[model samples]
Target: MIAAFLLLLQAVAPPGVATQVAPAAPSAAMPTASVPLPPQDWSGLPILPIRRSATIQANTSMYVHGEVMAGRCAKAVRTAQGWTLTLDLAVLATPQGRFRRVTPRAIDCPTVEQYAAGVLVGTPRDAIDLDDTQTDTWYRTSMTFTWAGS
Candidate 1:
C-alpha cells in the first residue's frame, strides 16, 4: 500500500518531468487565419476517452502544479500534520465519471481546507472496491499552499 501511494506521489512530479500524454499542439491542417472561427458543433470531432486512473492522476498533478506555479506553497514548514494542507479525500464514483460525493478529512489549515474542498467535491472519479463491497477509496496526503517569502 505504501509503495502504491509513493508511486502515485511520483505521478505528480515537478515540471520538466515526462508524462505519457504529449502536450497538444495545433494541427498543421488547421487554418492559419488571424481569427479562427469557433466550431458550430463538436459532434464531428473525435472524443478521446480517458481512464479514471488517468483522470485522478492528472487532477492530482494539476493541483500540485497550480499551487507551486502560483507561489502558493513557498516556505512551508513541516508540522506534525506534514507541512501541507494534508487532506483525506473520499471520491465517490458514478457512471457519468462524476463523483457522487466527496468528503475531506484530516485537514488542519482552514484556508487550504476550504479551497481544496471546493475543488474536489463533485469532481469525476472512479469507484474503488474493498473486500466484497464497492466503495470509494480515500487518498490522504499533505500539501503546502502558503506563500511566506512573498
Candidate 2:
C-alpha cells in the first residue's frame, strides 16, 4: 500500500519532495500485532479520490492547499513475529483558499529525543496532517493503509 502511495507521490511531487522521519535511536520495541487493510469492491482500477474543498494546516499558523497534496506518509518498523512494520505518521493537506498567515517549517514534527533533551522540538516531520478539524483545520483522507511484509 505504501508503495502505491509512494508511486502516487512521485507522480505528484517527485521523490525529492517526499521526506521521511526516522527515530534518533532505533528501538527494540516490536510491534504488538499486524492488521490487514480491508478489501472493497470497486468499479475499476484502484484510484484515490481527490477532494476539491480539502483544507490542510501546518504548525500553528501554516496553511496549504489540500488539493495539491498527492499523498501522505508515516514511519516504518519491523516486528520479530511477522517482520511487521509499525508506521506512525501524520499528514496535512493544503486548503484551497488563502490564509492570513503560513509558516512552512512550522508543520514539521519533532523527534521525541529532541523533546526529552530539553530542545523545543519544532516541526519534527516536515508536515503533519492533523486529524482534528478544529485544531488541524483539515479533513481525513482515504489512505486505505494495508499491512505489508507481515
lDDT of 2 by residue, 115-136 (tens): 1111111222234332323322
lDDT tens per residue, model 1, 18-117: 2111112467986533222223443343222323432344455355445545666443354554333344433333333333333334334333443444
Which pairs of residues have clashing backbones in candidate 1?
84-143, 84-144, 85-143
Query: Highest lDDT, which number?
Result: 1
Cα lDDT over the full model 2: 0.24
Ten contiguous residues minimizing lDDT sum, candidate 1: 15-24
Please list the Cα RMSD from the true structure of every candidate, rounded to 1 decimal place.
14.9, 18.3
Mark the regions of model 1 whose C-alpha exceeds 4 Å error after superposition. 1-83, 122-150
Q: Each candidate's lDDT (Cα)?
A: 0.36, 0.24
